[model samples]
Target: MSHPLVIAYHLVWTVYGSWLPNDPRGSGSRTVRFDPLADLGDIHLGRKRVQPPRREVREFYDHAADLLKHPVLDLDKAARAIVGAALGEVVAAERYTCYACAVMPDHVHLLVRKHRHTAEEMVTTLAAASRAGLVEAGCRDPAHPTWTAGVGWRGFLEHPEDVRRTIGYIERNPLSLRLPVQRWPFVVPYDDWPLHAGHSPNSPYVKRLRAAGRYP
Candidate 1:
């Protein structure tokens, strides 16, 4: 059987399709270019601008990540509830071992166990559910886009040491080797962890990658 994996995927999208060049604000008018670090050869997977994005676009992206706070308790209850509930369901249905989750206004952070599904499936389900939930809650307006275009990252778990690293990043302070397992593992990388890769838990590659700070 294929070994299970620990994966963490972000809602890679930005509001108003801000990351793509096809949108009005995303057009060259903003002098935006793609991110050099993530770009592949000549193909720009994302957009950048010489000038900052228009206020509206900036506000939209900013708001998407900010509304993560409890909207109902605050002002945007419907939006917050959608994310909160959607994350809960995603965790429950997938039976993922969740590490740490933070629902940012525009996006969410889910460190979940990697199991039967692929990273693509996990992200897709989360996005769909969150969108549906928002609509049901009367927060998602048809006039505005529900999601950007894609998710942020679906980093595959690379090794035990790396898993520890990510857990820390997600702020999971495991108790004395302890804590009731949150769900599955909390954070699973794409699927390259030593254990997930069918290698000995202390495989040398894990060590090397850790030393190089590229394990994840």
Candidate 2:
């Protein structure tokens, strides 16, 4: 049998202007806008940097708040549902396996297997679909974007343990935040994943992946 070409990714993205580039609490150089006084260190395009310090990060947020076009994102229930459905549709249409996802008020977490697309491409497509859904649902204004410009954070899940840990994190994010358990229609179980039982044992996708030993 041909080895499965399963590649997994754990992705994180924030709402527009929610987590700024100059955020003191550690930020990426790509997210920072042009600023005269910004003390940018280890300048690398689209890479995360260790935050300067908690006090410094807080100060930056305090000062930068006035310059923000929008306040911190806190999506309502309707908006969350719209975005979740949109993400699910994108996954299905792209033939990607979505292991888990969480749509938080300010950001989102997704664990998906890459197929016929790069991680960046998947993030961009998902963001675009979500923005359109939000606008169509009247959850967001068409004139304003709902997501940050670039992909926020992405890490490859090269090992089965990594995939398992990420899936746990995505599933438990809401509970960790002291919020109600998140349940969305988009989350699908992988039959080959021994860590989690498959929801549909007879599903063709599950069977194919299982037969090919593509659990991770």
Candidate 3:
């Protein structure tokens, strides 16, 4: 069957060392770049599957940690806030519309409305801004990487229900990570779709056009 047109994207990415090539939760990597990592554990290239126990998975990454070149990133409360602020700037500067955003300890979830930029571009830009924020705030070392080695994952969202589901999912990511729900200044509530309001009502783009707040 054909897929519906994508109205938005649900993007997710991990912090450095947070997820490995061989993870119980799974990864998107096709090949293990680090030879040492090849035999350390089995690689689960797909997003997720029905295999491996948490105990074994932890042991794998724990041993794998010693073979890494940089420290693992586990963002603290302050660091998450800093990253959120950096992202807020990007929303204004890039003129992007964010339906949901949550900064977790090891990863981030974003529900971004379909825009002039592609989903890949959205992840890249947001990740860059986050890295800059962490470095400038001394939350991260400039020599180390903020995100994973790859481009991360992005799935298209087409329907209004799909968009709403993704919005809820991103917002709840922090809680799943055992962190509190994140409230980023950049995130706007997903109200209605473009066909109804001439644009998504709560989106940054329309918020800009409403009244005197043109272009924020």
| Candidate 2 residue spans exceeding 4 A from truth | 1-6, 36-59, 70-72, 192-216
Which pairs clash in the backbone of model 2?
24-57
Tens digits of lDDT, candidate 3, 1-216: 234456788888889988877776677876778787778766677866576687987887798789888888788888888888888898889988888988888888888888899888888998998899899988888999989976788888766677887788777777775777777777887765653545555664344344333322
Q: Per-residue lDDT of 1-216 in model 2, one digit per residue for the tens?
A: 644334588888988866676554546654345464255322344434553666876676666656667554567778888899999899889988888899998899999876678888999999999989999987778888788778779888654566878888888998877878887776777443423454565555445556777543
What range of 10 consecutive residues in model 1 has the weakest lDDT sum? 36-45
Candidate 1, residue 5: CA error in Å?
Answer: 7.5
Q: Tell me the TM-score of each prediction against the true structure.
A: 0.51, 0.75, 0.85
Worst 10 residues of 3 by lDDT: 207-216
Q: Which lDDT tens digits does candidate 1 get at residues 6-57?
A: 3443223333333334332333222234343122122223344454447855
Q: After superposition, how far is residue 58 of candidate 1 from its true place, in Å?
A: 5.1
lDDT leader? 3
For model 1, what is the alpha-carbon lDDT of residue 8?
40
| Cα distance off (Å), candidate 2, residue 52 | 8.0
In terms of lDDT, model 2 sits at: 0.74
